[model samples]
Target: MVTATALEAELLELAGAVPDPELPVLTLRELGVLRAVHVQGTDTVDVDLTPTYTGCPAIEAMSLDIERVLRSHGMREVTVRTVLAPAWSTDDITPEGRRKLREFGIAPPRVRDGSDPVPLSLGPTRTIATHAAADPDPVHCPHCGSADTELLSRFSSTACKALRRCLACREPFDHFKEL
Candidate 1:
């Protein structure tokens, strides 16, 4: 007989392997969206997830993907829950995720130092991270592999990306802004 712990481990592995709909380059584990996977009983699995941002439209799709992946793998009664506290940070993105982001022509965020640059504050007593909303850091060129890039706009095709133009290759690309 398979122990609950072992079953849960398998379930977690399966669920964590599901890729994000918006960020197809990274899996839930690579994105650090997967928080916890616990077995409540012999047949029930519970999962905790956090979104990249509060208004991220991909949250619903991610949740549904998690459930679908688990069910297709023969697991039943899987529950995916999202939590907002301890807010998600770009630091949560894995090193693999960073590599994948770069491979996709989108520069990944720099290593986080516990200081996030998000604009909104959860509430009083919460130290809100300050981002350079106007002029952002100089982004590197993912095309020609040069650091000579100029920030065209702080916003990109997605809320998490910044538009940049490479001076060397004269190519335009998006930088995955670190949150």
Candidate 2:
């Protein structure tokens, strides 16, 4: 028989399997939203989550996904609690999560150094610049690896991303804006 701790671990693993509704390529873990998992009893599991953004519609679906995954694992009495304090940021993204985002064709958040120039190379340049909304970076095209990407629209399919087109590849794709 699995101990309560073991059951909690299993539930966490299952929760990690549930992808963010907004970013299908990213799991709740990748988004740093799955805060904690606790086993209330032999049959009950509790999960704590933080939303990526306020008023994000994905939270509803995320809650449903958590409940569904736990139920599928035979944990019928499951509760998902959401916390709002200490707002979420791209800095909360784990290294593995960043790697996943890169593989998914969305550049991870740029770490700024207050005055460092924006990295212009796709092959690892070491400089940072503030990614303020008023001073957006020259986002590279994820598909063709071109620094010659231009913002097609400030809004994409989701609020977290922007639509961009690669001048070299001539491909339109979504760029995860720095926030």
Best by TM-score: 1
**Against the true structure, what is each candidate's TM-score?**
0.82, 0.75
lDDT of 2 by residue, 1-179 (tens): 44447777888989987988877788898888887788886778889888877888889899999999899888878899888776676666778777777778876665555643444434322233223353554566667666766666666888877677766778877776665
- Candidate 1: residue 40 Cα off by (Å): 1.6
Worst 10 residues of 2 by lDDT: 123-132
Tens-digit lDDT track for model 1 on 74-152?
Answer: 6678888888878888889889998899889998887755584656433443122222353355456778777666767
Candidate 1 global CA lDDT score: 0.79
Q: For candidate 1, which ten residues in a row score worst on lDDT?
A: 122-131
Rate residue 127 of model 1 by lDDT.
23
The reply for model 1, stretches above 4 Å from the true place, is 1-4, 114-137
> lDDT at 118 for candidate 1?
52
